[model samples]
Target: MTFIALTKPQMRGLLAKRLRFHIVGVFAVSLGIAAFCKFAVAKPRKKAYADFYRNDDSMKEFEEMKKAGIFQSAK
Candidate 1:
């Protein structure tokens, strides 16, 4: 006479199963990415940007300021 729907227990069990599947999918994706990085591409090394400064004028100014104790001047 009446149609039956999912009960609380049935809904909870379904949600639990779905959550388990999602967790497993995430783990599988993470493993795939790690494997790809390990076998496909080598990690890049650190590149120095300090090469942009050729003469080091900023360095000399810093040393001069330190000698003159300009940082202690009251502003």
Candidate 2:
């Protein structure tokens, strides 16, 4: 039946109207997630890295290793 199948023009028109909205919505959601990750998730990770590097014990170990000649000498 004609009602069961969409005509070519009907399909094309429907796609043309709806596809742009879907694309824009998807783009917006992706941008939001990226921004959230950058501001929310990345901040704590950066803080953790900074704390690890700045800890007294870590620095002491690093200096000890350097003094022990654990690292390769630069030519």
Candidate 3:
């Protein structure tokens, strides 16, 4: 096994290559976090409410309350 010492230019090139790899890694991690938040942290409020109100009994009760002016805004 032979030990080799890097020259200044070689060291500079190696450092630049490592810097580029680090930048790419940071961007990849950032994109992964963004994608995770986009997919995993989203709450489908409209769809959830639609599903909740799709039940027949609840729909009937809501309509009855509306008919009784329970949801009317005061003038």
Candidate 4:
């Protein structure tokens, strides 16, 4: 198949249009990403549980009470 050649002015105009389209596309994409990061991502919760460790006495006490059925488990 023979290739169709574009005239110089036509090619230049096409290039400029393509460049403008790419620039606008990139700018819009960047704005979308920034907006998503600012508004869509979950913010760190101010309330977080303290780190639980087995050495914590309250955890052990609750476990023991459950095993002893002090609250009378239906099972």
Report, for every candidate in turn, its global Cα lDDT versus the true structure. 0.72, 0.83, 0.78, 0.70
TM-score leader: 2
Q: Give the Cα RMSD of candidate 4.
A: 9.9
Off by over 4 Å in 3: 1-9, 43-75
Model 3 collision count: 0
Report the lDDT of model 3 for residue 61: 80
C-alpha RMSD (angstroms) for model 1: 8.7
The TM-score that candidate 4 achieves is 0.41
Full-model lDDT, candidate 4:
0.70
Clashing pairs in 4: none
Tens digits of per-residue lDDT, candidate 2, 1-75, equal 356775565644788789889999999999999999999999989998898777658667877888888878721
Tens digit of per-residue lDDT, candidate 4, span 1-75: 999997665644798899999999999999999887766563322222233342368867888888888867632
Residue range 1-56, candidate 1, lDDT tens digits: 99899665564479889999999999999999998886666433112234445545
lDDT top scorer: 2
Off by over 4 Å in 1: 1-10, 43-75
Scored by lDDT, model 1 comes in at 0.72
Q: Rank the candidates by lDDT, best first.
A: 2, 3, 1, 4
